[model samples]
Target: MARSTLLEVMGRHVQANHDTALQCWDGQNKEYIPVSYSLLSQRAFYFGERLVNTTKADQIQGQVIMIACHSPYATLVAFYGAISVGAIPMIFPMPLSLGSHEALTERIKHWGFAFGTPAMLVLEEGLNEKFHSEIPQDIEVIRLSDDPAASTETRSKSANDHQPKSDDIAFFQTTSSSTGDHKAVSISHSNIISNITGIRLAVDMADDERMASWLPLFHDMGLVGAVLFSFCNNYSLFITTPTQFVKRPSLWLKTMHEQQCTIATAPNFGFDYCSRLISEKDRDAMDLSHVKHLFIGAEPIRVSTIQSFLNKFSSCGIDAQVIRPAYGLAESTIITSISSHKKPSDFICVEADSIAIGESIRIVDTLAFSDADLSRYDPSKSVAVCTAGKAIDDMRIDIVDEDGNKIDAPGITGEIAIQGGSVAMGYVWGGEQLVEEFPDQYVRTGDIGVIHNDELYILERIKNIVIRNGENYLVSALEEQLAELLGISHEHIAVFESDIHDPSSDIVVLVERHAPIDEDQINQLLVAMPKEAFPINQILLSRAREIPRTTSGKKRHFYCRKLYQSGDMKFQQAIEVSPQRIMQAQALVNES
Candidate 1:
């Protein structure tokens, strides 16, 4: 059993399944349109060959190519085309609002200028006319619509015809949650192939297994794990937009059941959404008996959320053992550790007070631990669900103290560091000096976690934690506890420190309060909050609608932090307007 390059891996699949139906869409004509693998493969092959042959004309081999497209074919072409030509391909998440558009353009400028002009900008049909207007003078431009039958000749030969070393740089993807100037993580062919192989083995994916995924192609989970993994394994897959899942989560599951999806993975929040959206009527009409590997990842894994999902779906014949809690990041190419299929996994829950106080893990009985403290927690006693699970294949994980000494204990918590064949090359800015962070082989995840009997548990991002008055506060933990106490509904929340510009510093909690409450009620609640859990000096509440969130529904803390610092802050003040006040306001309106 010999492993092949990503390009060759996908090529073999495309060649074998040339006439197999691949893409399906409900068109405006109210009918299903299916595209075969041969169509998609040939389309990308033309563009891929053109990229290489044209690059030789300019003597550029590794210049970056950014693709902005919404069509399924365009996305496939953009990704495989870059891989075929040995150029660094990057994808930009579609900007929603005008605010996001401004932010994305600024990011492109920053990266483009930093990289000394891109090789070629690839735009899909409609965007070529609208967005291509501002292209930098030095960079070349190519449209996906330039030639529909472009790769007919190029599809004849395999990628083996053009030898690309395993170490050749394939592409770069920036952290989607990034703000201001974007930060990119570079991944090579070997990096992706290694991770994909490890992931395939971990999931026990057979050639006949099917995967259903709605995570965005720009996100690592969907791009490398779900999409690329399917291609590498020669498995069929069903993919749709994240917005489609958000609009109708039940549809995602319904389609999966209809397709008899055996393996599927999504962020934990997607499970939560499906749990909330699948009403009694919907549940009664649906059957999800075929879902085997229902993976939960990309965000904090809540035991309660998993339990809720299992409880709700168990009646629909969905097995409780199918709910697998996994952890991963882009630097590792979308898979770090996944739960074992040997048995149903258990979660780790500790006393909240101990964790808040930043104390070492002290395991009491589970029930006793829950009753002892409500705020702070010790990581060691946390439910096993919190563990990222054991390392796979050549991957090695270490929990190191601040002094770089490894802690060899189950209860010991420190920075999570990983070194493996699957680890990425590093971040790319410009020139060859781009990736220095992973100069050796290790990728410092910048995540805080603990190791318990060989299981890695992620506590939170070190950068997201706030330190004030000699106490470390996990803002997310505080938000979670508050949500439990207040009965708030949103899974996404962000807590950021706000400065008063006073000589005496004060910590302000900018919270997106889910429930409506008066300032007095909020203040009272804050005063009564568990001090040992997360100490707070002040409370600033906004409605849940006011919080800035990613398309994936993850809170954008950097945006919220900026909103607090800016004078544009608006608070949802609790006040009931009386009829008299309304009449007065009406009179004022009449006068105006």
Candidate 2:
């Protein structure tokens, strides 16, 4: 096998399809915006040349630079340009509110000072007029345009700079984590290329495939998987913001149906939301026959949720075989395991008790699942409706037990450890020290899983397990029971530990319910919930429409927990009126 650079691989596709439409989007004016492969390549080449000439990126091969832009075209160009010059691109998140703007700017200034250089800051064209004064004048800002011939006469300084080796760092992706958690995952060009190849093989994607996505570019799946993979593979892409999809889930299907998109991907919540929104009348009018791989990922896969969606949309041309469950993280570039097409299987459920307490997985007959002791035997299958698939071509995955020993059995559940060409070289900060954190060369994905009959099944996040009294409570287990009992939307339910005065531990459920519930309804819910499964001390209900979520609809649990702890969420309290009030008023009038 030839080991080619990312640019080398992508250039081949660009050369083959120079005039083909590669990326298309709707602009602010609702007009279709199109960019071709020839244009995209030229933009990347010139921008990279300009950076090498002015920024001396060859000398600072391991340094970090931030790119800030709203336009999809500019972001893509700047991303490829930074990688082309052997500098790591750090994508700064857009400030959510005006209040956060100054603090985020201060953070950027501190980071720039620490890096000891005015990092290259790319801005959207119109943003110059809006916040140009706020940006430091010392930092270089470049504007990427749709024209392939764009250039500045004063740009030539040192095109003679030496090129970088394949081992140099390419980018640092920032993920949401605790301060103690190392959130940034460093990736090299080789790692990214391997990931692209791995994903291409895992999904069995074709050259003519098209992918529609609404995930934010800063996120791993959107940046590496959706955009870069699409560009590298000569696939057409239709992308928009998460807010746009949330406002109208129908639009995702409508756009896909119109474009005949074959490879569509999203987190588990996205599918749940789409299933809820697509009205029977509207679904009847739409066409979804072209969708081949509707991927559910970025979170644990729930069997019931997927089955409900298939049952709801089976009449609307949605082939149940298209549902694919995958597992991956930023540390592994993007995709580690994806569902396969040839064998094809539906979502499977399993016992949650065995997962958390028994430390094993036993595939009980799916038919006998409902009648089994609901506490000991999971009503749903332990395995999800999908499989995480075999490791990609050059990658390797191992299920290991404690004491760092690899497990050989198919039913034993353990930590999922991955290694191979696509596994990131190491993280950005702490260098060798961070490399030491991982075992040998494998990145221990903080996820639990099992290998069954050569396929992998993910259980739950290792960090999310709650230690209550002497027993351990897996949050996902509690969440699953709550979803089935309360009829709460699976996408909106999150269970976390709360600090209450009770000696017995407390678990809080932040549910996204549309209608306000009275105390009686809540009490009934508590009564119906399995007592041994999840002992609820307090339950909080909030509407999903008002809840803050990522562009992918994953809940911001950290922030929501903070708000709840501070007594910020509003809950309705019923007040009683008595007839004795009228007698008291009459007595007071007589005395007057």
Candidate 3:
């Protein structure tokens, strides 16, 4: 807290641990490379000086700078370089799926539209043409060399010569499109520090703890939580690329085991992927006993995924309780609530229809509630909901109904709204805050959840629900039930509501299974589904692995619905062989 800003925090860590090192994967040599704090400082200094000179020539200070780099080292150097010289840095996603030149150009142009021309852009080669064509600012795109500071490069000036205040904007993190499309959340030096400090305390971090992370640096989890936090706390960090994890997730665990990492994290789907993808042979050889807290959050925490992963790896010394479920969003700087102690995650199962984000706080000041009141809020009686741990220090939660009325009773579904120090400055559009009708500080998370036993049980985002006949159904729960009934993995199914407000709007469920469903099974499932979950007016089947999802593995219900409404989507009917219903089904399937 004594440090004025992240610049000071980084400086202190470098000064104190000059010899301490970070271990990163070297893809070419298939070995981990050690990069010391002193070396990082020198590289940062070199990049910082380059930025300082550019901004000085442009006669602008505090110019927003964008950095899009694939290599973690290059990104760290570019980011620190920008901020060390008083320029704000924004780390952008380097889409690995950019397979074609047109795709790359469109992606860069899309980014340019969201971020009004930054004074300087630090990107890897071959991405500047599209950037320049779309942006109108007097922009200078700095190409990051493979090893910019590897040679005998001396800084012409001190790295932290330009000091920024605590209130200075540190960076802008893009919010995930759970509620909607992504938006930039301006995070301040103080905001980042507050979140890190709170998380450090919540998890009771120790000096000797080792951290390993593969999250993209563009996201707040990797930016503020993993990279910055590791440096600030002086913990030895083992970093890897997200692509590496996707290609062979076993590497994440293998590296963690080899380095004896104590702290690690992933979203729900990450765990599911690793559990399913990592072969039994690979799983048997790995050891995860060193991991103390595998914090799980970023999206809805799936109880089934956690349980299956634990069962699959427990023989390899991976403790079941180490799988901690957490809850937070970009608006709150990544982690607002996380499991802080050594306890098994409390899980509950409830009727999908009965579950609602109850009234922990429908209104902020109008209710008197305490942790002791959690005795009355028993999740086991209703549902595990999420039991997403408690709020971090100085943070408060409110669950309100659709009418804006407070819901104080447990198990009552409502939208989640929060107020805390970790909250971002505000939503930014075109480099300006949208304050027309939004709150000055507190963020309405748009996630629906209920508070029980002093923990958050997230149901789903308010926008993710399917409402028909005045009944709201959680699509995730329906998908889980349908997958079990189909004897297929949950990834094979996607359920959503189309034409949302129309009285005759269809409730469509899509499944991508290897085998087709017969007419009898289809009729039986449709009949039972309405009673167990909700009515599915239409069922569209696609080839396996064809469902679209966000980068974080969240099912893109809205996107899939859009694709289905347009015959342009690639998929065939599952019940196309049924002579009696093929015409009706095809008409509904191709209705869009």
Candidate 4:
């Protein structure tokens, strides 16, 4: 088998599609900047060669290079440039808001140790100083805008450069740790290509398809799936910053419409964000029916989100089926399973224990569930519905018991284990690849799930489950429920087990409210929740601007738990609260 290099695979396609090989949203111009394939590769080679020589006067092969850029263009240029020099580049997303320079420095310091001072950090403008003196002086810091490669000066290719192989590590993907740490998993070139191939096979990626995404370059879905996949497959990719999308979601719709984008992707919260925040007036002039593969992943799929987005955008000519529900992990390059062929998503509504049908959470109830009758399982209960679709190609998945034994039957809950070419090279630890033998084995996904007739359904991360009355419920599910009840978006609500052992109530639900805490709303929640769902001990009202989120935008509940315990969260509890938690909640509110 011939070795497949990143440049080798993408360079071939871009040779002809030079005109619109890459299209990035030019916010200043209120338009997109289309860079030709020839220009893109030209910059990659010129700067790549320069990077190889400037960083070190030796073989660049296998050297871990880091690229931190705010500009999507800068990140792309530096990434391919580093890769072109045969040095694996790990891309990190510039933090959205750093509040202070000290916070930024701390973040960089963490990353420096995470990868053990990569040979060089191709940092963005104004960010070079954050890493200065904090890390070893030997680790060179190259400002992206400074033109480390000096684009104008043609640099000669060195023999040490361009030695990429199939099995070589391509880049590192960041995975969030529970302890507020960030871990980067090594992804190989083969893993990326194989995963993209699986995406192509699973979704029937058409040659005529054009891609659009606002997901940050740091995440795999944005980097590999949208950005690099389109490049390698010879299609135009439309890129924008996540901040721009949040500020004006209408731009995303407009960009998609203008480019006639056939494929697009976002996390569940993103769709929910646009669905709620994007007013009907904002979408009056848009058309979205052209989209074929509107992928939703990077977070647990919510039935309400899919329905709400589809419902809200249906007026704009979007087919409800175009909104897909998909599942994946950073361990596997990007997407492993995505619904395709205009199929309506499959939603399984699991009966919520001690929940009655008349309850509030029952609004999401769908009839397709097998446990429809009260006899099969208690039907008089508020149920949580999750969209679980079929698996993609080139991937093998299994539901395993606690002991690592595979579950023989479908619908049995167990840990989700995945075996595929998409599986990353291994976890990077102490400047070395920890599991070199990882390729031959299944990456134990720490996610609890059930596979029914080959369809994968994620329940929750093993750590995020809250058990009450001997019945388990996911914190995400509670978040989803509280979002509906509170008339707020899902991402703003966080649920976690503050005290796991308490018999009466241990779970704490935190709501991100911009204004002062509403005592009436808090009282309403105390009255409505204890009967419909799990009993929440206390509701902590917080003003945390950036909900601690993973690169892919999944909420970090464990971190939030710590913030609550340490009293660091800008939380103002309602003056009046639950009887069991009134003393504590009121006391915290009194301090404010």
**Cα RMSDs, all models:** 11.0, 12.1, 11.6, 10.8
Runs of candidate 3 exceeding 4 Å displacement: 55-57, 97-104, 110-118, 125-138, 156-160, 177-182, 356-384, 403-405, 431-440, 463-592
Residue range with the least summed lDDT across 10 consecutive positions in model 3: 363-372
Lowest lDDT block of 10, candidate 4: 354-363
Residues 1-592, model 2: lDDT tens digits = 1355656655676667645534445545553457766566566656667676667444645445676665566777777677666666777555531124553465456445445455776665665355667767676666655332344332121133335455556677765311112246777677777888887887677778988887667667778878877766768888776657777787788778777888888876677777788788877887777788887766655555566677677776776568777778777888888777775544345554466412678565332212222244333333333467778878899888744578876778887889988888766543334232344548777677877768887765544444332123445656777788777656667665543111133566677664666645544554455533434455666654534465777664434544555566554332121234334444554564
lDDT (tens digit, per residue) of candidate 1 on 451-567? 665666665454554433212345666666656655664353456554211112344555565455764554445444543333344555566566776577667554554566554
- Native-to-model Cα distance after best TM-score fit, residue 592 in candidate 3, in Å: 21
Between prediction 1 and prediction 3, the one with superior TM-score is 1
Model 3 CA lDDT for position 380 = 27
Superior candidate under lDDT, 2 versus 3: 3
Q: What is the lDDT of every predicted structure here?
A: 0.62, 0.62, 0.66, 0.66
Q: How close is candidate 4 to the true structure, as a TM-score?
A: 0.74
lDDT of 3 by residue, 14-41 (tens): 6676555577787777777777777777
Displacement of the residue 540 alpha carbon in candidate 2, Å: 12
